[model samples]
Structures are given as structure tokens and as C-alpha cells.
Target chain A: MNPNPPLPPDQPRFLRLFLASEREVRRTVLAMVPSLADAEDIVQQTAAALWEKFAEYDEARPFTPWACRFAQHHTRRWLERRAIWQRLLEHGLAEELTQRREALRPEMERRLAALEKCVEKLPEEQRRLVTGYYYDRTGIGALAEAQGRSVEAVYKMMQRIRQALLECVRAATAQEVEA
Target chain B: MCAGCDRAGGGGVNFPSPEFDGAVAAVCDGSVLERQAEELNALLRTDAAARDEYLWRVELHARLACDADAILGRDATAVSEPAPVAQISWRRAALALAACLAVLLGGVWLWPRAASQEDIVELVRATGSVSWSSEDGRVRPALEAGARLSEGSLTVEGAASSAVVKFRDGSELTLSGDAELSFSDHGKKRLTLRRGAFSADVCPQPTGHPMVIRTPAAEAEVLGTKFSISAVAEQSTLSVETGRVRLRRLADGATVEVASAQSAVATLDATVKMEASSRGVAAARWREDFRTKPSELWQGSWLPAEGAEPARMATVPHVAATRKDGTKVITQAVSRKDSSAGRIVSLMPDSVLTMKFRMQRSKPVTVLLSRHESSGAFAGNYELVVPPSTGQTDASGWRTVSVPVSSFIAKMRGYQQPPSGGQVSLVYIVCYDAKAGMEIAGVAIESAHAGTSTNP
Candidate 1:
């Protein structure tokens, strides 16, 4: 079976995951901090904190749900610092979080667009290799054996391919402004 | 492995399969992947340099991915701290006292202690620039006119004049004209250039308390590295020369970690946008503001005008003709005093003493062109309070402000009376603030015939 199946036009799994996680993080943080601004600050802090502590994460598990748990912890800490009345005010705050989640979707889409432009500029074979690894989760060993090359050679080639793609994006964007 | 390749040969070779693995290892280690990978990549129709460069980036990506995995592994369960000993227990109280003493001592050794109030210095200038000359005669412009310089902190009126500051740690910063900048000399340094263009090459301290450059539009902090920043009037731009700089805009408050050769521009009214450059292109420059050569100052020395009396109390120093942006510098030693102010006095007849230099600051500066009265005591008169708003931060290109000696020191006895009879000893271009000191970085005095005569 082909591992890299295209998503349907109606399917918004990527968008859904991005927005849902962003919204949940915001909502969970707001539960602790009564102020919308303060909640946003905590959410951002939590995201950065998550990134900084990324080594603790397990790639096998889902990232969004795990990130939401971190958001909840930070939110609880924020709420604990506030007055009792603030706690009562935020009881139904999560219900209003959908708007913020939807608002962030466009920004994510734009970044994805930039990423697409960057990836397209990669050499054709490199592009295929990246797509296979990221999208199809193909093992380096399997790829190497299939091509009758060692795993080291395959991994090294993959590394160069990724670097080339990154450079292509940088040059494209830099020239865009210079032009 | 081929016999030639096994000897760690130079470029130009077709390597066997085993030698290719060695070359791949070399690329992974960031050395030039000598012959094998280059040859194989050629066969694979891949760009050799691109492949080598990508190896480093992919390693970083894998590291980041690994870090993500580690963060996810933290036990979500809360770990409680040990209970504090009750005051009722005498042994616990003694142990707590020892711990407190140890902590205090350790902190004193680890962190620099705050200097006593007497050790604190307050140097202020309203409309002057300050520069430091090294033993080798290399003069560094530390602050520009219409700016204030104090103990480890420099603030300029964003609209008046921009300042290019170099910290002791080799961090170079150019504050956009008219921005307020404050720097703490602590190991974990802090810089707050409230509004204006600012760029720095920050060296991080342990505990990684970022060296912060705060502005109206954004805040850029670094752990340890080189970078440049231009805090435009309403927008701030950050470009990393080496290492990573974290930029956080105050609006949506998005934070981005900018790697080397990458730049981000954030404005008060716009969303933050970032762009990256090729590594070689970005690493070449680390400073945000550029200055003309230091030797430019020594190139044109003042020569007494023909038929003019050797520089006397009444005669203004003569300088070679200069453009509107050109600066004429006069050097003098200043004595440290318990209570003192900077004054420019002593003039010669037909003297056209002009205070012309670049200005960058946001607040109004009380520029005093003062000379001592007959009593030989410092006096404040002939003050030109240039408004805070009148300079460019970016085109900052160059503009000159010329105040005639007659107009500048008119209120003084020499300018008020005949230039021959009145004696002017001390002159001052002092900021009115008793604390926020000003820096007179560069100054020039044009001969009376500055406009007409080419020879000094």
C-alpha cells in the first residue's frame, strides 16, 4: 500500500490540530489567569517552555494533547495566584475559546504557504526524499537497503537535502524583499 | 578505501565505497567533505556545498527533535518539596542560619555586588557627544549629541540624535536617533533603549539571563552572541550576525528565535516578519551602525589663520574646511571633581566658534554654550534648548547644526562686550540635569572665514 496518501480537500486535519492545540493552550492558561492578556502571556510562555523542555517529549505520542496538558498545569498555577472571585469568573471561559483558535488558523496557513514555496525550490530528488521521510515515515535503513546503499549514506544524503531546501527558502525570501 | 584517499588527500579524486563513508563522516563533523561525498553527490546530481551545509542544519533539526522528545518525558505528576523545619526546633533553626549564611556568601561570590552610592557616577550632557580615545589613538564614539551619558547607561532623545555604543564586553550597539538606552554593567547585563535604533553583539552570561534591548516596538534578547539591531522610529529590526537572537514584539507578543544571518522587523503597527540570509552573507557583518574611519579625526588639525594671533582667549580655533557633516575635534583633559560641570571657555577675536556635529536623541536638550565671567567662575548663559524632535534615525545620513560663537556665547561677557577686553576662561555645553550626564563625542570650531577660505 502507498503510505503517502493525499488528504481530501474537505479534510482539515492539519488545520484542526494546529488550531485546536493553540485554542486549548490558550483556554487552559486563561483558566488560571483571569485577564485575557495574562492568559495569552502564559500560553506563549508555556509554548516556549515546552520547546525548551522538548527533550522530555515522546515523539511516539501525540504532540497536541501533550502540549494541552502542559497548558493546563501552567493555567492551574496562574489561577492559584489569583483571588477567589477571579476563579469563579473564569468557570465558563473555555467555551469562548473557539474564536481565538479560528483566528490563529490563517497565520498557520500562511507559514505553511511559505514552507511550501521553500520546499518546492528544493532539487526534485531531495524533495521526494524529504516528503517520503516526513510524510511516509520511511526508515533510513529501509531506504538505504532499497537503493543498495548503507544507512549512513542515506541519512547523510537526507541531511544534505534538508539543508538545500532551507537555503532555497532563505534565498527566495531574501530576494523577494530585495527585488 | 583508495590508498590516496586514506591518506586524507586534498580535493580531486574518485573514491571507493569505503572511502565514501569516511567522507560522509567528515561532512557530518562539519569539515569539508574532502573527495568522496563531493564525487558521489556529483554522480547523484546534488550540489556539493549545499549537501555539506545541510548536514549541519539537519543535525540541529535532529537535536531539536530530540529535545522535544525529552520535554515530553517529564512526569506530569507534581513533585512536592520537603517540608520546612518549624521554628520551635532549635537544631533546625541553627541549620537554617548556616544555610542562609552559605547562600549569602555564595551569592556574593557568584554575583557582583552593587557598588556603594559614592562609587556611583552620574555624568550628564544635554546636547553633546562623548567619545573615548585609546592609548593607540583610536577614538571610539561612545555617545552622540542631544544624548545623556551616565554610570553604565546611555539615553538619547530618539528624534534628536542616535548613539553608537560599545559595551566593555565587546558588544557594539547603535541606538536609533532619539532613543533612551540604559545599560547595567552587571555580568548579566541589561540594556533598555526605550525608543530608537539599537543593535548589539551580546555575550551571554551563565544562568543565561538574556542581554535585553527593549524598544517601543520590540524586545531583542540574547544568551551569548553577535547581532545588529536598528530600532527605527516606530519599527525595530534585528539581524543576527552569529548565534541566535530572540525577538519579541509587544503587539501580538509573538516571540521568534532568529538564527545567524536571519533578520526580523517588527513595528508598533505591523505584524512581525522574519527573513534569513545565506550563512556567509550574514556572518560578515555584526554591527548595526557604521562610522567613518577613526583616523578622520586626526587628518585635519587646526592651523592658526594667517595674520591671526596664536590661539588666544578671544580667537576661535581654525580648522581645515569641512563639509556640513564633517566634524572638527579639539582635545582637552578634564579633572575629576567633587562638584563640577563641563564648560568650553577661552576664545580669540573674530572667532567663529561653531558647535557642529550629528545629533540623535528624543528629548529636548539644554545645550549651553557658556564661558566664564570676569570673576573666573563657571556661569550658565547662551543656552540653546533644541527640541527633542529634529533628527533622522535611519537616513540618519548626516546633517550639521552650526551655532555661531557670537550667538552661542553672546550672553557671556566676551560676546556681550568687545572681544578684546572681556576675558572668557571656561566654556560649557552642559545638560541641565544634575544627574543624567551628556557626552560631547566630537566637536569642531570653524575659523571666521570657514565659508570663504580653503586654507587654515
Candidate 2:
């Protein structure tokens, strides 16, 4: 018996499309919702809503765009409930900001592409801290307490590290553009 | 600071400012104060440059959170526990209690079980392997029937394990399979289903405070209702039998009102989907007499009620396989072709299963009730255990047992749920032991909700 049985025709198509485009969809939500946690929430909701509404998708169009559109819609809905985000959506700045981000998409992607290499060049300890803080979703306060450092000092250090990574990504991207 | 506006400041979301960088960084790391959050929100709404900078930081954050495990050669941050707790002492206690339960005195050894003042809840009954422990890591003294505790964790180990807990207010929670639940009822009733499948009958609470149940993926603020929730690390599913429950996805803070007969799933990825569950099995009653041979049987012969034997189906198990120590013998019978081909036999919640049988085996006997939906969808498989304590008093060794079908729990976890007015496609009598001897007089099912019993 073949242990790896083929998925039902409907499921495989959706899963393949979704998996191929998930990172792009998360990136789309990240443009407007800058907080990783909140953007992640919107992206997850968008994924479910997309799956539920997958049958209605226009196959002629690209999958990532459709997925991003769903992500944007969910992000807008999510934003409309909160205080500042609600204001942004209501005042139409959220749309304008989206347009601005869309125009900057190429630059952003280039920078994102260069990020791994830049991260690889960081000191081993700094790399661990970056990965620990960002990837592990560890609370800053908890991290600080565990490391026997003040939360403020940790945040300041994190800010400096982020600035360094940003500079490195920009430099790498600029070099790529020159090349 | 993911998204908020409950602080001070309106619109100073300036780019390249020290305060802006500080605020954004603080928010990203979840250490933002109220004032900083309000200021950040203002900046995000008004200034495009500020939004751009913030997005870059957030994009970085998002990438790291998503691929941290990959970057570190490990999995991403775990879906944090509902609340951190669980000890292996529970497994030890469970094993020890299981050993104690195996011992029989003249058949049934009745242990003294009574509720004490410290007990806000009592363990009404426990089947299969179960263990209990407190929040601070103290094992329960005994796994008695009426095991009571003010607050502690009760875990049912193995797929076959299940335990019923009843509160002082008559609210009940049933935990099944390899699941753990930590509970306390001080000022407000609180239960954290760390991991497991749990069903609850919650009573009306005090005005402001509702019964709060926290799982990894979902949180339920239940006022009063009958609901079942299955909690796993990545997802928590809720099925409401009656009344209503407010279920919140902890990941996204999205809330949904799950009404009666409705079901919902809160996933770790923060998706909440609500839909109507199965219509459930239509109510019905059934009975079977060993007038003829069963639909399926192995290593068995039918005895036509000769002498004092009554109409019986006798099975003497023969070795089917050999293990290192000895031979493994198994006997199973699915009662006659009454539910053959297209016919559907519905068994409701209040259905009473009455069986007359005699068994000669070291292990306890199991009655399996397998079911399917009217649409031919696989529903679930349920079982009722006849423990060794139900001794054979008479010389003939025959015993009559009638138990509520509601007592028949699911045979496997994370599968279809237990019988709730569902179609009975198969009923099996099984004995697992070498040289096992089993004799079945008859079997009958009487569902009060549907109608009276019938002679077949």
C-alpha cells in the first residue's frame, strides 16, 4: 500500500497555492499592521477566510494577490476595531499607506532578501538574542528578568541591534542594485 | 502594542525621532506603557514615514517569529500553555491506583468514598487509567470513587481512560482520553484544560463573573450551558449541546458566540470557524436474543439453552499469536444481522444496555457499540466495561448487567465523539486473554427517550 496517498483534488490545489503564497500574504499584512503579533493574527484569519472562500477565486489571476487581498481585507476589519488603526482606516490613511508600501514593495523585498546574510554576519551572541527576542516571542520583561538586566536596557540594546540589521540589509540591497 | 489606543497623546508619529524608535521597539517587544502605545498609534495613523519605519521593524519581527526555529535549527516558539503545570507524579499515582483497582475482595472491594469540607468538587466515577494531583505537585492520596479536592489536576491517561467530575453546584466536567485538566473554584469557577477532551455542564454563575476555561488556543467565558471542548496544543474545538458559550481565540482576541448544537474550532493560527454539528442519531430502541447465531463470531459455538445454561453463545478462545512469554488469544462477536446491509439501529443518550453474560478470563469484558451516521458517515465507536468486581454469585456463573448507554464512552480519543442518539451499526462482545471462556445469554437495549424495549 502506498503510505503517501494523494490528497483529494480540491485540497491539494488549495494547499499548494496557499503554502506557496503564505509568506507573501504575511508580508502583505505586515505592511499595514506593523506589530508582528497583530499582523500575524490578521494573516492567520486571512488564511482561514481564504480557504473558506477559495472556490470563488478567479484562477486566471495570481494566487498571491488574491491571498494578499484577503489578508488586507481581514487586516482592515481587524484595524477598524482598534483605536488608532480604526482611525487610520476611517481617515483613509490606511489605504494611502498601503499604496505607498505597494510602491516601495521592490525595495522592501530586496531588503528582506538581504536580511539573512546580514543576520549571518552578526556576532553569535547578538544572533541568538535577535532570534530569541523575535522568533521565540519571549516577553521582554521576562527575558530581562532572566538575564538579570533591566527591561529598558534590554529594549535599548534590541533597538541598537535592529538598527544595525537595518543598515546591513540596506547596504546589501544597495550593493545588489549596483551589481 | 500590536494594535491599541488606550493611553495619552494624539498624533506625533514622527519619523527618525528617538521617542518614535523607542515607542515602536517597546511595542514590538510587548513592554509598551499606556502613553507610549497611544503615541505610537497616533504616529501610525498620521505619519506615512513613521508607518514605513514601523512596518520594516514589524516585517523583521514577523520573519523572525515565523522562522525562528528554522534559523535556530528548531521549531518556533511553542503555543504557550494555558497555564504552565503538569508533573509525572500523576502518571505514578495513576499506575499505582490502577494496580490497587485490579485487586478484588470476594469480587467487589468497596472502598470508603465520602466528600470532605476541603472538596469543592468530587470525582463521581473514573474508568480506565486515571490519576490526580494538586497544583503544587502533591499526588492524590487515593483514586477512590468519591475522590474530592478543593482544587487540583485530574488526568486520565491512555486512550481508554475517562473520569467524571461533579461540582457542589451540580455542574459536571468529563475528561476523556490522555487529557489533563487543572481546576479551582475559589470566588469564581476556573478550569484550565491544559490538554484533553472535556465536556462541561456549567450552572449559572454570579452576575459579573462567569466560569472561565482556558485552553492553549481558546478561552471560554461560560455563564451556564452544556458544552464539550477538545483541547490540544494547536487547536481547541467546542461543541455545544445546549445553551450558549462565548469562545475567544486567545491568539487573535476574536470572539464568537457558539449557540446550541453549534460547533466551533479555535486554532493556534487564530482562526475561529463556527458551523452546525451533526444532527446526531435519531432516537431508537433495539434488543437481541441468541435465537440464532450472531452476525460475526470467532472461536465460538452456540448452546441452545440446554439444562440450566439458557440460550447461550459460548466461546473458548484459542491462541491466535504467540508472544515472548505466552500465546495471545482473542474472541469477538458482533450481535446478529439485525443492523445488516441498509438498516440503521439508533441508540440515544438515555438508552439502557442490558446484557446477560458469563466470562472466565483474568481481564475485564468489553462491550463495543460502533455507529455510523444516516448518510453512511462513520460516527463513532463506544464501549462499556464490565469490571472484574461484578462477581459471579450463582453456581451457573451467569450475570445480568444493565447500564445507561450514556456511560458508554468513546473507544478512541480524537475520533468521532461518544454516542449521542447515533446509529448503531455494530455491537461487539470482546475478550482478550489466552484460554478465555465467554458465554452470552442475551443482549437488550431500551431507550426511554425513543420508546420501550422490544423482544427480538
Number of the predicted model whose lDDT against the real structure is largest: 2
lDDT of 1 at B359: 30
Q: Candidate 1 chain B, which ten residues in sequence have the lowest lDDT sum? A: B281-290
Residue B385 displacement (Å), model 1: 27
Please report, in order, the local distance difference test score of every candidate based on alpha carbons: 0.40, 0.62
Clashes of each: 73, 3
Cα lDDT over the full model 2 = 0.62
lDDT of 1 by residue, B3-48 (tens): 2233334453343343444444333322222234334345323343
TM-scores of chain B, in order: 0.30, 0.43
Residue B311 error for model 1, in Å? 41
Model 1: CAPRI class: incorrect
The digit string of per-residue lDDT tens for model 2 on B1-456 reads: 111222223455466777777777655643344456555656677666777777677667656554444443331223222221232223123322322232212223222211111355666555455667775466653243445555778776543346666664556677754578888876578898888677776666667879999998888998877777777667787777778788888888888888777677787674335333543443486666677654442225777756766878775442222232332223444243222122235767677778888767646777766554453333455888888666444677777778887788875332355567556645667666545577788777777656533322
Q: Residue A23: error of model 2 in Å?
A: 0.4
DockQ values, each candidate: 0.02, 0.09
